[model samples]
Target: MIKPFSVIATRLVERTIRINQAARTFYACEKGSIFINFGVIVVPLIAVVGLGVDVGRGYVVKARLSQALDASALAAAPYADNVVKLQAEFTKYFDANFPSSFMGVDITLAPPVISDNGTKVTVSASAILDTTLMSVLGEDTMSVSASSEVTRLITPLDVVVSIDTTGSMGSSDGSGTRLSSAKDAADILVNKLFGNETESDNLQVGLVPWSAAVNVAERGVSYDSGLNTFVDGHWYTNNSPVPFITEPDSDWQGCAYARYTDNSNDDDADHLLYDADVGGTIWEAWEPMPRRVVNPSNGNLYTVRCPEWGISKLSGTKSHATDAIEELSNPTGTTTIAQGLVWAWRTLMPGEPYNQASIKSNLRRAIVIMTDGLNTSSYRDAYKGDLNVSEMNDRLSAVAAQIKATGVDIYVVEYHVETNLMKSVASATTAPYYFKADSAAELEKAFEKIGTELSELRLSK
Candidate 1:
């Protein structure tokens, strides 16, 4: 019994010592773990938050770069002609729009050359931005670029200044009488075409005075009815033959071919034909042609008659048809739009004496056919019985088609076309044609908008 009790007591003491050692080890381990947890978790959380702040700053800078690039592109478009000016403008724009705080922003423009020759304008620009947070990820900076090539807006413009010269033109619109306002608009266009006396050479202007009938400039000719005998009324000469105005036929004996002629040796043959009709009492056949020279003294009018053919034709002179515009005050007769359209086509035709150069080739060719009233039957007595609106529309549409086929753009404007019969007629033509204005102000705004769209500078050398 004594041996057993001694053994028991010794075991109890060993257990107590072992328990105390374990308690001390637990306390030491808890202290060490607290330090390690603070370093590994809390420190990394702070570093991650710092990186997020830097990343956010980088994004903000990148967004600014994008906006600045767009603003700079727009500022550069207008100055595309002057490279130095474009660069200067870009710098100004970039500075104003993209002021960077983190790092300096740089912009570059390529091919700063602008040609005056009719061509397209194109511009390329790039921007570089520096980042703070991303740099910590081994990325020090970021770059962005943008490019925009705006083909200078070329508006197809055709305007028939059908001034309401009727005595009412004496009334005022904005500044003065309707006539005065019309003149102001015309002068604006004139100034635009010719900056000074020298630049005027590149542009052509023709006047149409309409009262009973729209009479064109002395140089203007109408290609509507009588000429339709040639090519079934299609004025674009390439079509099949219908009629030639200066033919020895009985219809044109009283008139002469006043169109322009090159100094071709063969023009003398054309003169022979004209002379036979004017001077000769009989018709003659076409033969091998000889070239003729234009009389410089006659403002470049070619009047050489058939010397060999013994035909004494009258000299070529400007048309006697006065401008019908002066009589706008006495708009007594009915409106025949066919006549107006024909005249418009002639005014834009090339190779014609009145049309000095091709308005189509050099400048944009556009026609604005506007009318308050519908087709009439009074003036053209020949078609009195055949009062077909459909027929009239077909004629107008045919002419429009021919003109458009030749690359001339057309726009038809109507004051009250919705309830009118001619609305469908204008609608069937090539491009956009419509009208829905209730007030005069709307009308004027529409006109101005059309003008702006059509007058956009078409870049050409």
Candidate 2:
């Protein structure tokens, strides 16, 4: 009994000592637990925030750099005549748009790569951004890069000017007549085109002066009519075969009247081949009756021919065009703008009689049609049936549509006229192409603007 009691007491004492040691271990283990929690959780949280800030800063750098690079590429495209010039332009533009350094940030730009055709340019810019919080992670800075590409705007321009030269063009405004003002403006336009370069393979110009009628059938220009017989100078009159002419030509003039659809369907929307034709001896052909000699006793008419309409064929030289204008005689007869438009369209078309220079692929053709008066269908008019002003406008509109359909840009300028009718004429084409000149000086300015507008810049990429 005594031995069992002593053993129990010793075991109880050991149990108490073991319980005290466990309590002391619990207090010691929890002593610095708050600091451990802070080190483990708060440190990583701060690092993550710092990384986020640094990464956000990298995005900012890239966005700004990208904007600058894009601007630089675009500004440099036009001046990219050579690598040195393009690089200089890019640097100038980039420096102006974005900072080379921001708060110790350094930027580097690569020499832009210009495509073989010089139409496209690609550039890349990079920047090194110093970090704030991320430095704690042994990363002192971050890198960002931006790239951009740009394309040039204009294609080569082949332009034609079909101007009215009726007696009405000689009618005066406050200063000069319409014809005179047009001549001055055209001369200035030519100067702008050729500049100092006497020779350019890219630009070609044609001039058509129309009055009373155009000299297509009578003048016998090569046309799609499949009628090459005009070279023989034997032409029908008033729908009669040449043999039907009993009297000699009293006044045989080479003036193209409207063809079947051209005259009957004056507002021809299809703008088929008929609209381009000047017609033949068939009722479709619109030519003035052959001149007849008055037997004096019988008062018979004779076929006395007048000179054909004058056209300056397509040429690349300013001198050629200006000289042709100089050769033009004083205006006479009625206004037939449609004929002038058709002939001008023909001048730009590739193939025989014209385009001795050969039609280059991808040629950009354009037309500038100027008229001082409205179209008519009197004896002065070329159509078989008389057409009122509205009908005349419809015909003009149809012809304009046809020309544009051929991928030829058309610009219409009405001189001293402010009618929507004229504005409608201008509206048939792209915007900024329609011009209403109230004065001679304004006319000149319009021509200048046309020249500038034709040589414009557009964003390609």
Candidate 3:
């Protein structure tokens, strides 16, 4: 067994060589496995990072799409009546808001949906974003969508249109008579407010066709304990005798003079020209007296020939307003803006000679006064027929302030007349409350714009 040492040593060397070769082979295999594992991890890591980036891009695209959709819906809301026009408006606004190929995204807009009897508008859109590194997972693109809706509802509104039927309106404004033009403009406004309904529970309109005086018609008269007479819900006494009157109180016509304490003394007078209350102050019947001019044809010197068209109280019936407007003919008398405006204010109030209005806090009241001339008459000169321009303007301003304080918006439309008085009365410093029209066409456009604004469009979604 202990034979030759050389043979044993050779065998041991051979064994050692084999062991070293095996170790080398194992090392090479371990290095190859590490490379394979690194390669396998790199693809999934890249996919995860790309997923975050692409998802973030999709979110951005979705936000932009939602905003554009909202804007488009609102823009198209007003044109809900016509499908073609509504779609045109929606596309116009959406394109303006969101550009094509924005954020490397492909956008597709769906057609607008109009419902609820043309009161609701709905818009939707979809976007696709191409994937960059996520293509390894077979997802070449990401999808996002957005939608928006808008609804327009009309609010409760009460409007009184005070048209100037003075003699100056009988003249021409390069088209037709100013009075005719006013009628046409007023008709347009009424049509807009009424829309398809002949009568509405939330809408009421009144007409006050005024000139030098208003024809209040015949109203009941009662006597108080102090011999004071309550005529047409206004208190009056013998002390303030009907101005320059020779006829008895029973024969009194429909016209009434402005309220004042005394008709004789202008210095010691307390003017109630702007008061709308029924029980407090004294009033006087409007009697032209001996100043009446005789008609050459009839040989009759009518004592009181006020405006033929009288005041029409607030009513929801469209025909009532249109009928009153149609009767706006044969305009004759000087301009008395204060009288027209005060009467309009009274019509809007809940308690007055005209009690057609309700006392709701949410009601929106407005006065549209269209005039073609300046103030030529005043309460102080109602009997004398004197031209008190300054006093008339002051009274108009005071009445306008009082009306505005009661949350009633006053819109002044001066047709064929240029004056700062109307602008000031309308408080035009902040809004487009005052409009000046030199022609009949311009006047119609102005009234149309006002009517559209008064219609009150809003987003309800």
lDDT of each: 0.40, 0.62, 0.69
Per-residue CA lDDT of model 3 for 1-461, tens digit only, reads 22122332343355446545654655566554766655655665566666556666666788888989888887676556557867898999998999985887777889987774555677898877777666775667767888898865667899999999988999976667989999999998887677556777888999988887665531123312255455654544343322322232543334556543332322112223333333563343333322354545657654544676667888999998988898789988888887788778877777545678866668999999999998885322333344467866777787787788778898889998878888877856323478888888999878877776777766555
Candidate order by TM-score, highest to lowest?
A: 3, 2, 1
List runs of model 2 lying over 4 Å from the truth: 1-154, 216-254, 260-309, 352-358, 427-431, 457-461
- Position 166, candidate 1: lDDT: 30
Q: In model 1, how large is the Cα lDDT of residue 79?
A: 48
When 2 and 3 are scored with lDDT, the better candidate is 3
* Residue clash pairs of candidate 3: none
1-461 per-residue lDDT for model 2 (tens digits): 11221232343355446545654655466566766644654544555566666666666777788888878876665544557767898999999989765656688888898676555678997777676775565656666777888764435667888888877777776576677788888876776555444655777777877864565431223222223234233344432222211222334444444552433444333323323332432332234433333435456543332224456777877677777666555666666677678767767776532443336676778888888877755532555335676776767777776677778887888887655665555535434688888888888878866765665534444
lDDT of candidate 1 over 1-461, digit per residue (tens): 11222232343355445545654654567564766644544433443444455445444555665566566655554544346766787678767876644357455545544446422444455555454443333444445454444444533233433332233335455544455444444444333332222322233444443322333223223223333332332222211121233333222111222222223212222312233342323223221111233444454533222111111111111111112222233233344455455445555555432334344444556554555446544322212222465655555555555566666555455543443444443434323354444334545544444443444543232
- The model with the greatest lDDT is 3
Q: Which ten-residue region of model 2 has the weakest summed lDDT?
A: 239-248
My TM-score estimates for the predictions, one after another, are: 0.43, 0.54, 0.67
Rank list by lDDT: 3, 2, 1
lDDT of 2: 0.62
